[model samples]
Target: MQIWIFSYLHFLWALNKSMIIEWTHKRKNSHYISMIR
Candidate 1:
């Protein structure tokens, strides 16, 4: 039970981090494109 809880928590943490990374990357790309325009 402890192991299961830890695994689930870690998965959630990793997913959140990946989402933040993707969001920031897309935001940077958009900023760059806007600058080009």
Candidate 2:
């Protein structure tokens, strides 16, 4: 049971990390586009 909880938390952390990375990437892309325009 302890191991299962640890793995679940790890999974959530990884998912949140990926989402943050994606959000930053999108923001950078939009900034570049606005600069170009």
| lDDT (Cα, tens digit) per residue for candidate 2, span 1-37 | 9999999999999999999999999999999999999
Q: What is the C-alpha lDDT of each candidate?
A: 1.00, 1.00
- Number of the top TM-score candidate: 2
Clash pairs for candidate 1:
none
Backbone clashes in each candidate structure, one number apiece?
A: 0, 0
Q: Return the lDDT, model 1, position 24.
A: 100
TM-score of each: 0.95, 0.98
- Put down candidate 1 lDDT per residue, 1-37, tens digits, no spaces: 9999999999999999999999999999999999999
| Residue 30 accuracy (lDDT) in model 2 | 100
